[model samples]
Target: MSPFQPWAHGLNEIRFQGGAEGFSREALSELLENVPLAIAVTLGPQQIFAFANRLFRSAMGMADEDLIGRTVSDVMGDRYTPEIRALRQRVFETGEPQELKDASLMLTPGTTTYWDIKLLPVRGGEDQISGILALAANVTERVRARSEADLQAREAALHNERLALAVEATELGLWEWNARTGEIFWSERQKEIFGLPKNEPATYEFWLSAIHPEDRERVVGGVGALSDPRSGGGLHAEHRVVHRNGDVRWIVSRGRMLYEVVDGELRPSRLLGTIIDITDRRRDEEVRQLLVQELNHRVKNLFAMTSGMVALTARTAETPKQMAAALRGRIEALARAHELIRPAITGSEPSDGETSVAGIVEAILAPHVNQGSPSQMTFEGPSLRIGPKAATILTLVLHELATNASKYGALSVPDGHLRITWIKGAMLTLLWQEEKGPTISGPPKAEGFGSQLARRSVTDQLGGAIAYDWRPEGLQVRIDLPLSQLNA
Candidate 1:
């Protein structure tokens, strides 16, 4: 009762009776017509179609008259290439069956379809091959689906390759954990990050031990949060690690926990992420904080000193112009001292953050010293280290003396000259003498702000004493300070 039941009888068992009721040509044709495949028969050397089934006619988009007596080229047009002809000829001459998979055909002018084609040789009663039988199945959909999947797979591979290059360029360490297998994978860079041996396997216990003792507890808590659903399965932490050799490093880790559905329930399956070394950045941050604190303390001291200078200058100046000129000169001197100190405080100094007494004296007086004349100033001293605080106060005291000399003392005339000398022992002794300038009668009646500030700084701040002798030609000043105060 099946459409193909006639085929159940072997070819040798079939006896042609020349009637529709027996196994005859008409009966065979009827059986081929209802089969699912596209079946056709071609005859003789011209390969003219001798028979065509319903599916064959539909697949070719032709009627019986258009195909029955026509050669393959007449019906297929340009679509029947020499390759197809050679395949059919091979089947006819060798009397062997041939198969072609995923062959393309043009059933319509502009449309294409693919097929799996099988061709068989057919013989006449004379026992010689006379025709070809073609069986085909449409496979366009399957072939296109396979092609699309291949394209997507290639694109995904390219994407992963680019991502790996980016990670390597940035020196990022990659890691992965498989919860079900109790195994972990570490990239070569990841091993470098933890200072692990090349051949040593990465383990959870080793990871925990590598963390600094002070940070291990916090890191463990962060891991716990990674697995907790409430935390959205993500983690970010900055911590320290201690190597086997006792070298400590800072690191920042960022990762996420992956989940999979098992029996319709989501469960943690792996942890994956990257870690990068942050030791340099951490050190920079610490240095920046120290600089900020140092700058703040210095600013407060400067403001307090300015307030005192203003209050004291007001009492000594006979006019507002005098006060303004004195305040400006004092502040400018302070600014110049700040410039010398900043290089050390900001870590840009060529040597250690320490300055000697000779260095400070030269730096403060360099602007006032005339470049064209060598006789204007002279200095003699041994190198004595001055602390940062003492350097600030000493520079201010020397600047006040120089400002007075430039305005009214030895430095006011071209012929005037100044000499400085210092010696270091249990105490430091320094002398400032000026000569060949405007003659002075005696000491001033009232102590000016500059003189007051210099005296207070020497006696109160620097643990020293200052005395001035207003000689006829110019002035002389001598200062003595304990060695403890000079280098403190």
Candidate 2:
């Protein structure tokens, strides 16, 4: 017989008129023992077991096959049998049926089993309660599977929560792209990366515009190539982007194509990626490059300066002592000028550690100023920052001018004076006026090294204009520099 056969087998033992399926009493009892469901018939108030199925004997963990007259407490232990007996007694008293679904049963110590239980009260010839029939269906596996599924769902939720928190802490900007529709979604952090204002709409053109000019075309083409299925369905790139305020930054982008079966065919629909700010790293790389360029230029300049000093000393020195002193002074001048070249600080705030333009001017002129009147050459200017590149060239130009003045110009006389003034607007303008000193007969016809250095400092280093006017009173110099190059 099937394990779940609905009909009870050979149930002809009970007395009834016109019983259709008559069989020997012993034969009926044997068939009842072989039935599928856990069934039992109990007799008397104690609910003694009058008959028990093989399944019921196994559930009770009883060794004896014949359980015809034993009390339930005798076979199933007193700890649990009392509750079963109480349930039977209630059914008998009320003449009602009982049913319990998904109820816990402890058939063995430290082990739990679930059951769907049913009980029906039976009566004697006097219509008084005499016996009871009970049935139980096992539901342990079903209940266990449901509990396991609930635990897995809770764990999955917790894992996603932790992943989101980590992404937030690291300031990773998230974005989702609809490949076929050309639609895009940018998270708040992603908008910040793009330098977009609040509530600004995002579009593919906007993304392209944010990329650096030199890198934009390549990036756009690569994105198109990503749509090809043979391209491994992923994108990884490092490129540059210009912020809305004109700041340049490096971007590391990664994304993958998403697909789902539609009509049993895989088709791409979405792309997702994350971004982070990498401007600082890009600046560090540029600083390393600038260092190499500066070293090469300075070394070449040192050789030229040494050769010029030798040539100039030969013309002015008459004795061994005079030549040595003159050469030493010239070399000292170069050494002092070198102090003005600050370390290269590249990137947006390149003037961060550099000194002010006025500060550099004062340092170069300190040796030429009269000790009693340190203000012999007065200086005036508003706050202005100068980068190392501009400061180096300006230092050389000012040192040359001061040296010339100390020998034949303003500082040569006790009453001589020079005034230096500058202003900052769209551009920087600096004027050097010499007065109360020897008159300039004429401007130099031939440009020498000092003149060449001064001119180059203005045009090459400062990216500005320089002019000289030799007046009857004294020589006047005016310099105009781009305000941006001063790192203001």
- Give the number of the best model, judged by TM-score: 2
What is model 1's C-alpha RMSD? 9.0
Best by lDDT: 1
User: Which residue pairs collide in model 2, if any?
Assistant: none
Listed in order, each prediction's TM-score against the native is 0.64, 0.66
Encode model 2's per-residue lDDT on 1-488: one tens digit a residue: 12233323222335543356655556666786777667888877887888877878788877555576887777666445455666777887886777666677788888898776778766776666787777777778877887898899889899988978987898888889997788999988888888987599888889989999999888888777766666666888789889888988788888887776678876777889888888788887776776667767776877887887688667756987877865675566566545545434323333334477787778778777666654678899987877666776777777777777776788788778888889987888888888888888888777656677789878976789889888878778988989778752
Off by over 4 Å in 2: 1-18, 21-52, 63-106, 116-134, 146-280, 305-338, 345-354, 369-375, 439-448, 469-474
Cα displacement (Å) at residue 429, model 1:
19
Spell out the clash pairs found in candidate 1: none
Candidate 2 minimal-lDDT segment of 10 residues: 1-10
lDDT of 1 at 187: 88
- For every candidate in turn, the CA RMSD to the true structure comes to 9.0, 6.7
Query: TM-score for model 1?
Result: 0.64
